[model samples]
Target: MVEVDNATLIAFTVLALLAFVVALIFTGLSVAKKSKLFVNTIGEVSAKYETDITPATYAFGIWNLIFIWQAAWLLYAFGSIWRYADGGPVLMKPDILPIEFYLFWISCCLLYIGWLFLWDREYLFYAFIDLFLLTGCGYAAVAYQSIALNNNMIGLMSKSPVDVTLVYVLVQNGTDLFFSWTTVATLLNLASALANDPLLKRNLSAKSASTISLVILGIMVLSWSLIENTVWFDYFKYVYAWYAVLLWALIAVIVKNYDRTNYNSVFSIVLLCLVVIALVVKVAVYASRIS
Candidate 1:
């Protein structure tokens, strides 16, 4: 086994904590800005660029749950670091938050902060770019977490069923949930950015752009489901929180545009149904493997 020095692990722990603090600070600032504390809300800015696929206002409520779950995991990670710092036994080889995890998580947090600024300033295209980066980082972090979990690294640290469940809920599921939401957010950003472009607007109708974007997102989600089933099934067995969140977001879109006289609205519901079908197939595949 490769040995990790105490100092390096502690340093990452400190960095993780600092990065998380900055993320939360920016999150608060973004909220304040949205409240018109200093500028118009994100929703207000986003409303200006509304596309046919834009989810209902209520869809954004998922952010509350996302943040809460993320906070829980980071705090759990914090506690794990504290245990290590206080001379508690190293719960596992390496550490819960590996260097890769730190790199991805820190980068994700920083990029998200940057994305928020660009979004608030109405830099829709640039904001989408930053959001794309943020989503990449989030997915990378989740991938690393999945690797660790599949190797039973997290399970090693557990002392009881509750402990293991906490890791499953607050770490594994939490990371995946964040990534999944960011995936949805990235689609929204792309659609909005395209819709907001004067050049694109003159060339393409909003409904056309939205329909094309929705189709792309649906294909992406379907491809991801296939990958999860074939490659990451062992790593993510029985973990459906990400799917649930995605389904919810898709349902939100359907709810918002269900009555709209646009083909994009029909496309949105079709995408949701496709996602549901994929999820069912994935579950069945996993079930067969276990049985």
Candidate 2:
């Protein structure tokens, strides 16, 4: 392990805390913006289809709750890292506690513990409970989109300013879909890692897609972990650099074949690039501080 002075550790801790706060603020602003846009989009769609609608009943309302839940986890995880760096004990230990354990207990307590209830009631319910959690998250995301459409109808009728709302709705809904697809990709990767049955042929047959998706997810997780677990930042830095190139190549493909109908694909590519850019910027800032 690399040794660092107390002062440097404290500085890193402070930086991490600041970054987390900024991210939280941006996330909130994004949510508000998306909410407005969602309402407006519903209005446009309803108008185009010549149907009566109300924004108050937008499906995105559920998304507001889901985003809040995710934001809480982001805050807790960031706060935990800050505390540890600033002379506090670690909040979680990965070796002693599995990734699923932290994911269940700290990040998603309800789902984690809920699975236990099902497990005891029916021991062989499913070989992997994680898959169920994955499915639940996906379902929640879809429900959020549905709610967004409902609430959007209400916003549409008001005839209020919708420029900001449009932008927010576009980005938020687009990103929500992107995240949903990523969740699907993650579950597939997880299945490939853990599943042993030959009957599940689809998972085995798409080895190339699974491998690519896993590499992308691994890079993303590692990049975020670098900031959260300062001890491994250097190691992750190397991974980020290589992955950046691969991500850009993917972005190029999307851009080259740009189509308005393919918005979801474009959005996914753009979000992936944004994530890579964020990681690169973080790595550069840390490198400058060390130098």
Which whole-number lDDT from 0 to 100 does residue 156 have in model 2?
A: 31
Flag regions of model 2 displaced more than 4 Å.
1-128, 144-159, 163-171, 174-178, 194-291
Question: How does model 1 fare in lDDT?
Answer: 0.75
User: Which tens-of-lDDT digit does each residue in 1-291 have in candidate 1?
Assistant: 234675665676678778878887777877774444326567888788887878899988888888788888877776765454224424334454566776888898889888877888888878888988988988888777667656754445453335556767788888788878888888788787776754343535667768767888888878888888988888777567877887898888888777657777777778888888888998899889999
Candidate 2's residue-wise lDDT over 25-127, tens digit each?
A: 5434433536531223322322232101111223334435444544553444344444442143232221111222222222222343333333222222242
Give the number of colliding residue pairs in candidate 2: 21
Give the TM-score of each candidate: 0.88, 0.25
The alpha-carbon deviation from the true structure for residue 284 of candidate 1, after best TM-score superposition, in angstroms, is 1.5
Question: Considering summed lDDT, which 10 consecutive residues are worst modelled in model 1?
Answer: 85-94
TM-score of 2: 0.25
Local distance difference test, per candidate? 0.75, 0.38
Q: Residue 77 of model 1: what lDDT?
A: 71
